[model samples]
Target: MTLDLDPLRSGLHHRHDRVLIAAVAGGDTAHRTYGAPEAADAEIGSVSKGLTGLLYQDAVDRGEVTPETTLGEALDRPEGAYAQATLGSLATHASGLPPQPPYGGPRTMLRRTWRMWRHGENPYGDSVDQLLDEAADVRLGKPRFVYSNLGFALLGAALARTAGTSYERLLLARVAEPLGMTGVSVPSTPRCLGPTALTGRSKGGRPHEPWTGEAIGPAGGVRATAADLAALLGGLIERRAPGISALDPAADAPGASRIGAAWLTTRTGDASVTWHNGRTGGFASWVGVDRDAGVGLALVSATAASLDRDGFAGLARLRAEADRC
Candidate 1:
């Protein structure tokens, strides 16, 4: 099924910007976009962590690792920063970590993460040394929702270690390739960003970076086309409510709560959906699927919201359309 989504068409219609919507359900795929580009690909951001969590689960289903795997042991680091954290804790965002790094620039973010792992505040740091230091010095409360990028980043590292390969390799071999998502990548495939706020032709803006490659691979670096993301939604939705649950802050923490990985899980009547949206400087995208109702949806926009919930609203509308379909 393609999509019965004309009502939810580009709420923001303009020149030089766009939105794409794709859906799969009852054995069909359909997609549409505004400002569509032949090479329109952008990062899924923290949604990458959720995909990493799903990959970790896939590993468990394949008997590669158990949910009980200690963070340190899982990554083969006995005294690492996140050593005391467990796989479940990381997956659930109960590991005490700050939301974003102390800094904003990607390079600065990496440096600050290392510092927190070493000497600064331990909350948002992402380096091995900084994490080890923080892990030794700080202890998170049991089962409390901490919503942390550091937590998910550690989980990504653990996944790489479990797969005995790079995070990029694991993402490609286990996810993108298997699903025929050549347009999807944890490490971007020929990544580049245009000069615009969500794809506008704004002048004087800098050309954006390609998400930090392997550096942010697990956290927020997966780039994908709208159609490719719809395929991923298809897979996740098709496999929903099974022995697997994607790491979603909205799902793990409900009621418009602030949580890590910034994903949302909403249940409508008998149907439950897990979803997320992504943005770089110039593009935005959303992808989601319902486990029980067999519905999936994808949306991408060149122009984005300063707030990210627009994507969620789009998906909600998609679900609403499905009610009629």
Candidate 2:
């Protein structure tokens, strides 16, 4: 039942300067990191949203919240159209929220560009209170398949507020700790960066600042080692992970026909792969599983590039190999 990941790793190395690949097929597991330690931390970008989805489901299971729970109820906000959207809608990107709070106007765009080009700073960093303030006075679009970072940020805040804890602690208690993902974390600031944290780079090889902030943590601030993330994939595949129900499809998405919480399920060859990918200023990651086949793969890179196809290919290969076994 042992899996061969060399072919997949070789292909990934061709596309990325630094890459990490981990796989589990038929109860066998393997992981390899190139130009980085297997234990080094890397930004997981919007993959954090997938984790948030898990938190939402776990809250549902605990009777603290339900899919019908509105943002206004969880966040204690005043009645408004924007706050009327349910947590389920937010989890599935059908909440009609924008990708993020609007930072319109020429001056704001210029400042954001300056920070990114000059200092590699993340412009999305905001505190929970700040994000909540932005949610106020915002307009909602028709509920559809718009991917939203703001919706997730607000969802995380709502979940935390309902539990009477910070999102960081809630994530730890409800997901990371239970799953033994010690390397996974949502850092509030750059000062909390781990010593083993890997520095990511832009496509042009320019180093970028780590994406961190309490407000954005649920949306894109998660970081983890390859080993830890791979373990997470394994937990999900085994259905032992808390919030495992998050993988069940609840809406439609682009590319993937069905969306579950934050995971996307798409048919690749004969297998239905449930997966999520992430990207930050400099880092990219992809995690996928064919639950029926009990095979999973997680790939991370320090370079900012798409890894979706590579991840899907890797998982397929693992499933194929498992079939032979």
Winner by TM-score: 2
- Full-model lDDT, candidate 2: 0.85
Local distance difference test, candidate 1: 0.58
State the lDDT of candidate 2 residue by residue for 260-308, as single tens digits: 8898889877888888999888889999999999999998889888898
Regions more than 4 Å wrong, model 2: 13-15, 79-81, 104-114, 117-119
lDDT of 1 by residue, 108-218 (tens): 557744643344222231343343344443445566676666677667777787778877788878877766677775542333333321332111233343444444567
> What is the C-alpha RMSD, rounded to one decimal, of candidate 2?
1.9
Q: Give per-model TM-scores.
A: 0.74, 0.95
